[model samples]
Target: MILLGERQILKVVRFATIGAYLGDEDDQVLLPKKYVPSTLCIDDEIDVFIYRDSKDRLVATTEKPKLTLGTIALLKVSQITDIGAFMDWGLEKDLLLPFREQTIKVEEGNEYMVGLYIDKSDRLCATMHTYEILSGESPYDVDDMVEGMIYSIKKDVGIFVAVDRRYHGMLPISEALRIYKRGDMIKARVVEKDEEGKLKLSLRLKPLEQIDKDSYTILKEIEKQGGFLALNDSSEPDEIRKQLSMSKKSFKKGLGRLLREEKVELKEDGISLKKL
Candidate 1:
C-alpha cells in the first residue's frame, strides 16, 4: 500500500493533459504536467512524494519535502489560519501545524523545528511536540558540548531539548541560569547519560558548584528589581517562587551568599542591595 508523507517510486501507468498517472490504474495519483519529464513514458518508474494538494486531491510531486514522516526538521511558518499555521516544507502545499499540536504560539516567517505526522484525517501535518519523534541514541558522551533547541518547558521540571535537532536531552530547571522559552537555542554540556542514553544537560560553562550558580541568579534578580527585593529566607516558598521562579531552598543559598559577601542587607520585610 502506498503511504502519504513519504517518498515512493511509482511506475507511470498512463498520460493525460493534466499529467501522467503513476501507480496501478486502480490506485493511481497524478503528477502535475509541470513536473512531468517531456520524454517520460508509460511503465517508467519515478520517485515522488505523495500528499494532498490545496484542493484535497492526492498528488505526486518531484519536489522533495524538507521533512518526512517520523522525521523532524526546522520548518518556516508561511501563513496562519483559524485552523492552524501553515509551514513551508519544500512542497507546493504547505503542511498544517494544527493549534492542538503546537507546543508554543507560532508566528509567520519564523522557523521552528517540527516533526511530520499524518493527523487523524490522514493529511500530513507538522507538530512541535517533537520529543515523541526524536531518538535518544545520540553520538554524544559526558562533557560533550552540544547545542540544542528548547522544544518544551515544564515549570519546576527540565526543558525538553532536541540535541542537534536529532537526539533527546534534558536541561533541568535547577541547572538553568534563568527561565527559558520554547524554540530558544541552548548551549549545554552533557553531564550524564540516562539509562536510555538520553543526555542530561548542564548549562554551566564550567562544572561549577550548583550553589554558586544559584547565588548568581538571586544576585541578578535583586539587581533587576532595583537594588532590593521584597522577599528573603523568611518569605513563604510560594512567594519565593512567585518572585524568583526558584525553590525557597535555592533562594536561601543565593541570599546567604550575598549576605556573607556584604552584597545585600536583610530586613524585616525585604532585602536591600548594599550600596557602596
Candidate 2:
C-alpha cells in the first residue's frame, strides 16, 4: 500500500510527458518531470516522498518535507487564507493547516509546530494538536535544562512541549505563574519523570529566579485563605507542607521575598497580606 506523508522506494513503471509513473502494478503516482533524474529508465527504483498536489492528486517527489505523519516540526506560515494557513514545508505545494485544527490565531510569517495527518477527504494537512503525537523518549534527567517550543495548551491541564523539537514534555499549571501560549519558545528544566516516561518540566530552573515561582504560590495561597496563613517561617516543616504544599526552606525564601516586596507582612501570629 502507498503511504501518504511518508518516504518510500517505488519502481518507475512507465514514462510520461508529465514525468515517470512510479509504483507496482496496483498503484502509481506521477513523479513530476522537473524532479525526474537524468538517465532514468523504466523499472528503475527511486526513493520518494508522497503527498497530494494542489489539485488533490497523489504525486511523488524526491524532495523531503520538513515533517511527516505521526511526527512534528516547526514550520513557518507563508500566508493565511479564509480556509486555513499555508506553511512552507519544503514542497512545491504549501502545506495546509486548517483553522479548526489550529490551537491559536496564527499570524502570517509566524512559525508554529504542527504534525501531519490525512484529513477526512484523504488530503494531507497539518494540525497543531500534537500533544499525543510527540515522541516521549528523551535524553534528559531531573533538573536538566532544556529548550523547546510550546506546541499545545490544555486548559486546566498544562502546557504541552516539544523538547529539542521532538521529545514529549509538559509544564504543569502549578509550575507556572502565568499561562504560556502556543508557539511560545520555552526554556525550562525537567522536574520529574512522569509515570508514563514523559518529562514533567518546570520553569523554576535558575536559582536566582526559583524563589519567584515559590513566592507566587505562597501569595496565592495566603490570598485564598482570606489574606492570612497561620503557617510562617517559624512554623514546623510539616505545617508548611500541609498549609502551602512546599518545604519549610522554600517557604522561608518565598516569604522573605514577599516581606521585602511588602506584599505581605510577618506578624506576631503569622503572615498577613499587607493593606494597599
Candidate 3:
C-alpha cells in the first residue's frame, strides 16, 4: 500500500519524467528529480521516504538520508558547495547539509555524524550539532551508557544532541530537566534508541548528583520565598539560570521532592517553607 508520511521499501516499477515511480498496490508514485541518483534503475529494491508535498501530494525522494525515517545511520560527506555540502548516505542522491545548518564549515571528504530529518521545506538535511538529543540519553537501562559532548542549542526541540558524535539524539522540551546552553560539557546515558536509531539521553543521571545538589540549594531559596517564587518557567531561562545553572527539568525535580516531603510548599503566589 502507498503509505503517506512514512518511509517504505518499494521496488521501482517504472521510470517517469521526474524520476522513477515505485509501484504501490493502487498507483505509481513519483520519486522526484533532485532526489534521484544517476545509477537507480528499474526493479531496483530501494528505500524511499514517502511524504506529502506542498500540495499534499504523495512524493518520494532518494536523497542521501541521515537516518532512515525511523532508523539512524552514520553518513559521510561526499562534496561541499557554496550553498551546502552533500553527504553520501547510500541513496540515489547525496543529502544536502545547508551551510546555515552547519556548526562548522565542512571540507570535502570530511565526515560528521548527523541527525537526518525532513525540514520545513521538505528537503533532506543534516547537522553536526546535536546536544539536546544527546541529553535525553540518560535514565538508560543497565549498561546502556554512551559518551558524547554538547554541540549546540537554539531554543527548539529543547536541545539537539549528538551521541558519540555519530548518533543523533533529541532531548525534547519535556525531557530536558536542566538548563543547558550551547557547548556545555555533559556526559549522558543512552536511555533508548528509537526505531530511527535516534538516542534519548539524560543529564540527570547519578553522576551529576553534585550538580543536582547545588540545584537543590536554589530550590530551597525559591521555596523560602513561598510557593509563588518569582522564578517564572519562562523568565530569561539564561539569566535566572545563573542561580541554579541547571536544566529546568532538574530544577523542578529537586523542588518537587522538597515539596512532596513537606519541606516546602509552592503556592500560586510563591514558594514557602513548610511550617513545623
Backbone collisions counted per model = 0, 0, 50
Model 2 poorest 10 in a row by lDDT: 174-183
Q: Write the per-residue lDDT of candidate 1 for residues 198-256, one digit (tens) a residue.
A: 99998764534657887788888889999888997778987887777667877887788
Compared to the true structure, candidate 3 yields what TM-score? 0.37
Task: Measure candidate 2: CA RMSD.
Answer: 11.1
Q: Candidate 2: where are CA atoms >4 Å away? A: 135-276
Ranking by lDDT: 2, 1, 3
- Which candidate comes out best when scored by TM-score? 2
lDDT of 3 by residue, 92-171 (tens): 55667888778777778866656565678666566554332233333335336666545556576656655554456556
Model 2 pairs whose backbones collide: none
- Regions more than 4 Å wrong, model 1: 135-276
Model 1: lDDT equals 0.85
Compute each candidate's TM-score over C-alphas. 0.54, 0.56, 0.37
Ranking by TM-score: 2, 1, 3
